[model samples]
Target: MYTPPAFRIDDRQRLVATIRDAGLATLVTATVEGLMATPLPLLLDETEGPHGTLYGHLARANPQGRLPAIGGEALAMFSGPDAYVTPAFYATKQETGRVVPTWNYVAVHAYGTLELFDDPDRLLNLVRRLTERHEASRPMPWSVADAPEDFIRAQLRGIVGLRLQISRIEGKCKASQNRPAADREGVAAGLAASDRPADREMAALVAAAPP
Candidate 1:
């Protein structure tokens, strides 16, 4: 991910949390036909591997599931809160007018060999878990049992399951940590005052990041 020393995140716990919080990832793989990427939500099993294992599915029509990963590995990229930082948010802007705009963001990259499966039972379980995870916050949560059995089976048949056992993971949090305390504070304050939810989330990360 070309992370500088100050931006590197080696803490597995934090990396896992970031992945979970992002809720979706872009899966990238090498193929004979070239590289293919799919933006999908993946369920992470932190207990499954040295890093973690990811589970998800895509339409049967997506060739990404059928193609062979030339390197026998794939990458899942997760992006967290991010905000644009303007030079006006820096103390240096007033002192020397030397600052430029930059972005404050959090991201994680996971690499692993992918394993595809079509077993109805496992796919059913995967969909159920994925559904529950996303619906837990709802006033009335829905379940796989809410649908007709035959219809659910038919739906599952049209998709293929993906499992990636993570071999390596990397995280980067570019949150204005390289800036001075005053500049960082200014940046955080600017982002926090913004109306966008993403900017507010990024403000918290920037405020909490150690310089």
Candidate 2:
């Protein structure tokens, strides 16, 4: 991520919050064939390591799990709220006519060593945690125990679990922080007025961020 100094997000707590909110991530790996990527809902085990561990599973036949060993590193991307900031939304652009369209968003890039299918128990635990995290949004939440043991074990056989011990994390928060206060406020108002839910959510994030 090419992040300017003003747009860099160095706060660990804020970066973690953005990652958690993203829920899903893109995992990329290089191979002899080429680069392979998978968009997956991952379980972030913040308690496990120095920067914490990332857990996820892919189908046993998925190519990524079979490829990463050829390469030593992998990257996981977590994206938060984002919106298009139009020039019309900036007060400075209206006044000086110098501003151009840009995007306002938050994203985290995690680089780590690949630890694929380390242990069966650890894999099961990862699944449990991921299920609980997503189920938290439901009225009547479900659990891994809800399924029969044989069925659960059978299902697990078709997937390969993974662990990525994150060595580096880069966070970028491009939320109009480089703009003048007045222009930022104008952009926020414009995003808030949009019918799209994502734009409205991004507006709130920008409004809450420090100037």
Candidate topping lDDT: 1
lDDT of 1 by residue, 44-101 (tens): 9888988879999989999998988887899999999989999999999999999889
Write the residue-wise lDDT of candidate 2 on 1-211 in tens digits.
8988888989989888888989899999888879889999877778977887888999888988777655588889999888999999888976899988898888999988888883667767878889999999999999999999888877888889988888999999888887788988998899999999889988887787677
Candidate 2 deviant stretches above 4 angstroms: none
The C-alpha lDDT values of all candidates are 0.93, 0.86
Sliding window of 10 residues with minimal summed lDDT for model 2: 63-72
TM-score of 1: 0.97
> Against the true structure, candidate 1 has what lDDT?
0.93
